[model samples]
Target: MEETGYTVGRMRPEWGKGGAQSLTFVVTEDCNLRCKYCYVTHKSKGKVLNLETAKKFIDYLLTSPDIHQSDSAVLDFIGGEPLLEAKLIEDICDYFKIRAYEEGSRWYWKYRINISTNGVNYDSDEVQHLIQKNSGKISIGITIDGTKEKHDLQRVFPDGSGSYDTIHKNLKLWMSQFDASTKVTFASEDLKYLKESILHLWDEGIYNVSANVVYENVWREGDDKIFEEQLKELADYIVEHDLYNKEYCTLFLDHIGAPYEKEDFNNTSCGAGKMLAISPDGNIYPCMRYYDYSLNHQPGYIIGNLEDGIDFDKARVFLLAMYKYQCDDECLSCPIAKGCEFCQGFSYDESDSGTNFQKAKYICKMHKARVRANNYYFAKLYHKTGIKRQNFHWKKELLFVLDDQYASFCSYHNEKISDQRMDIELVKEGLKFAEENFMKPVFLHSEQIADEYLTDYEEVEVLHRIPIQAYREDLPFYDYQIIVDDTSIDLLDKIPFQSNIIFNLSYENISKLSDMMEVVWRKTDRINLNLSNLSKTSDLSEYQRQLEKCAYKINEIEKHTGMLKELNVLTDIMFIKEHEGCPAGEDSVTLASDGHFYVCPAFYSNHLPSIGDLKTGIKIPNEELYRKDHMPLCEKCTSYQCENCKFINKRCTNEVNVSPAFQCKKAQIEEKTAMKLQKLLEGRYEFTNIISAKEFEDPIDMVLDGKMMRGYF
Candidate 1:
């Protein structure tokens, strides 16, 4: 049976407000150069858009309600070297300018025209005039592969002569005339020269630069090694020059910085459905990439024409398919699934009517590699600077218990601290150490607040763990947290809805608490479900099944009530929000009742060895084990949503960073389930696909498998 999985709620698409805010005009299909890796099949056909066609394209774009209401719109003129038709581009710019000033309306509406061109025609007087006249409104992006040697390698003239010198001279002239935002788009497969190329550009005073590896070509093992080496060298250069803090190196810094979430992941491609591309022949496609000379005449590729405007029905289907298209099950479950880009145009089959999903594998590998590299770079930088990355942090609070009179306090701690009062002297020393280390102290108690000890400290969270039947009295003096279990499930109805509570549940009792969800719901819509006391002997499979059942029950209730309820299940993996695994000791340390400091409360409860004691100060032994990137498997695994509890790892595998098989399997199941639910509710719900379940193994592994077929494994 195909399991659709339980939905948390309706996962609707965020069809953004307004119509097309950007349009790309493919001005021409003619170029003087014949690049080796060019995807265009008819670059030599010399099909260019006349001034009449340009006007028609602009008129079609202005018809959009989104454009009419907007303050500004982007008009991009793209290749086959858009500069080849510089006069037509200038005329188009003048037309918009005249409309903006002559007409008493804001129809032109602060329009910005962008020209993407090779530097070959940038030195022309017509192009210079366009740049000079519309200085602020027009931005030019010139392609210069790198240095002269690198640029001449692939980007040569049709007559087999190097155009690097001409391009270089023209780019210099273009940069002098254009005061607007100018960027150099460089591309090269020569890994050895990649950094040198970037440095060369910087040396030439071109700071705003972006470079990319030619994606259409195959990358060999040697090439991969070279790329890694080049990236490391580039990173070293960036750090040495303090470029990490500068905007000039944004392209490089972006890769190592926080990942961007510009679009909803449910939509497969970027700007495809939203942005229209008008080809030279007057046919409209989703984006410029979809405008294949041979394929643009087809049904699925072309969304509309200049004569009739957009074909809404065909456009809807294309957009929906782009949103619904998943490469495979692995892609749906991967941790960085939301960051993955899928373009049907990239994998479109000329011979067939639809896209070829198989080609996505190559692109997926490259993306994963880039993600890995970025994470690796960030991790290194974080450890060196004591700075935090997107999902990883270095600072956390130490929760120390002043009183342990509750029935649920760990028996190990209870037995160790029997009849022992709070050690005021040790706590004072611990507090001083915490202050020195910038660690917040969380005081947990079963009774009244320790006012005398906590008076001097203003930044403390006091958690009161009380039995459900206990009498309600005055609110605690500090920021309070209530800790409860399944026994207190019914009593929650009496508690205020705004109270922050942690509902503790053992793996075995999750299903039994399902009946009490109504009370749980009434108490707080966002309650944290803590799975307490998990060990190697625990039956995780049963726990998983119970959790799934619970999710279904809650979802059913939500469906009837039309109210969304969020359950933070072990299987609910949010990749973008929770990019790092459990902080454990890296961010936080726990000062236990026994006057000893451990990695976390779980470590103390489990009777694990303490890292240090109050008198000696906090000293974590083998601290590297708690770092997120320390484990090879964890670093490579795309399931970034896992709690990555070191205590659980030690209990299950006798290794801190090594995840138990059951834990990994359970997480994978949850990720897959979430993805399935998201896919089912794509058009209706506004949820991002953080990770996909699509399986992506290394491409080399497949090659190895073929070799192993002959007994090489």
Candidate 2:
């Protein structure tokens, strides 16, 4: 809480130098009840932070003399049940109060004191009195999921009976005992229970509250749909009851949209190291991840050592690494640029790479969902925003066709191929097989990539070597594959034969995207936001290389797609090294973002079975699957915006044409709903074979309905 215009609070929170300003005092973790969803193992095994740790932590908190003036350090007393060690909590509180009087102002150093507890046990009167003495600073946060039945089903005592009633009774008693507001929260398997529980709490006269959706064993907010609807319903209810202006805060809402507290409020991205967390285990982690076993976390990473021995500079370094996960090139140019924050430290704990690709995929899907939602919002908000968009109509824009192929070509740039780590022969075979059997001539986007490092290669590339970008400056690559699709095809003639059907994407709104459903528009307080944004953050050298590899493949298809199709071959023809000018060798073309040349990235930098090493120019196991011939969903299911990935088979399931559940469930839903969408589209214009009212269980079923049977089926 620095003065206006000077917001660098207390020279930055230093670890070790500042006595443990943030104390998480865990009383005896041993508890009477066990939650089935508890991340930690039940029958508690970890040592509770005893009174000794508590005292030293207080001593540490006292050292933060500068911040103490502005705000006291936070002392969050957590436990299996803080009430289990109720006396210790009192002792700790009393210790600090007495110290404040003895040391004068230093003892009153902690600005906030919070206690997390399971409300099965009634809080002691002494504890209540201590809270009152603190002048409303000590608000106890408690848990209550819903009606007794669901609550018991989720968490229970050792005997396995539902403990909801006991907890509710204890909560009522605690609320009655303490004059201050209690924040009653819920953790429900189904969000419906959360709503019911909040209603129950309101009925009990405990109007003040805060709620957080509990992610499962994995640190996720679970299903976004159910979570959003339930939470929004909660927000609307609070506003209706005039409880919206209270001190209660919901992070779920804060994430999507928080209260507009400041005039400068803007979008809040993930602030991983800046918001920071130090586990009771003494290891430093980013944000809300206090519990999780990523063994690399050490005491040194602690932002400030409780014993006044830790270093802040190192912690600052840790913060820098978090937001800047060095990965793919998508961050710079992706439409959803703001949605690129990632935490690599957590990945070091749970994933093979320090950066979690799986989580990235989840984030990507969620971001795509967010884009869809924002698009809808943008349309509604800016309806007369008459800027023409990509008219994905039947008009045969050459670039659009190439762009379609570019979008459809599953860029397998970084997928780690199985076993064949250094198979040079396979690389050669794949290159040869692709070139001779599937040769083509096409125009490529030969845009010059940025970065001053290319100064070294300019001479060689320009004088004797082949041009990278075909001729276009906006494109990254140039003449490599097809000549036909990019040619001047008659648009009027193509439109007469083309299916003007309202593809499933017409009905594919934001709701179809499970990650982003609502928008909160809350503004977060800044620490050094615009100066240190999420873009320029990271230390992950490995994932960066991998990401550049993927971007390379995407760039490759984007540029050379025209040439690839002219020879009656797909974009990634297994081999192409035999041709004189075709760039498909050890380092024929470098990734645009990162100047590294490798095989296709889907084999994850192992490069696809090399073109020159193949027995035939067609060396892929199921080459047809890479076409419309093998895609069960894409052939029938009409998610025009959907990215149908052949690389899905090789990367996720090792089958080139195999569709993961992600594709099957999502794509089919869009396809099946196209009929309803037809009703909407018909009003806009005359319709054709596109609006056939046939139910499709999957994309293959759509083929059974005959959307296109000539060349595709």
lDDT by residue (1-713, candidate 2, tens digit) is 11121110012223234433454555555777887755444336464556666666555545555223323455667656666766677788778776666666643754466676777665567556656676555657667655676677777888988887777767655665553244433343445566666666566665544544332223245454454455445544543454433323332221221112222122223444443343455433344333442234321224554555345665455444422243344443232344333444444344454332322333443333333332232122112222211211110000101111121112222222222222333333333322222111121121222232122211011111112122223322211221111111111222212111111111122122111100000111100000000111322233223323323333343355421111101111112211111112211221211122223333324334532222222143433444444455554444443344444445555665555554454433433343343343344434433534445445555445655545654
Residue 490 lDDT in candidate 2: 19
Off by over 4 Å in 1: 1-20, 63-71, 98-107, 179-189, 247-264, 294-300, 321-324, 342-344, 349-353, 356-359, 391-713
- How much does candidate 1 score in TM-score? 0.54
Return the top candidate by lDDT. Answer: 1
Candidate 1: Cα lDDT at 573: 54
Give the C-alpha miss distance for residue 231 in model 2, angstroms.
5.7
User: Ten residues in a row with the worst lDDT in model 2?
Assistant: 524-533
Tens-digit lDDT string for candidate 1 (499-521): 44566676657566555554576
* Candidate 2 runs further than 4 Å off: 1-21, 42-46, 64-70, 101-110, 125-135, 177-188, 192-194, 215-308, 311-314, 321-348, 351-713
Each model's lDDT comes to: 0.58, 0.38
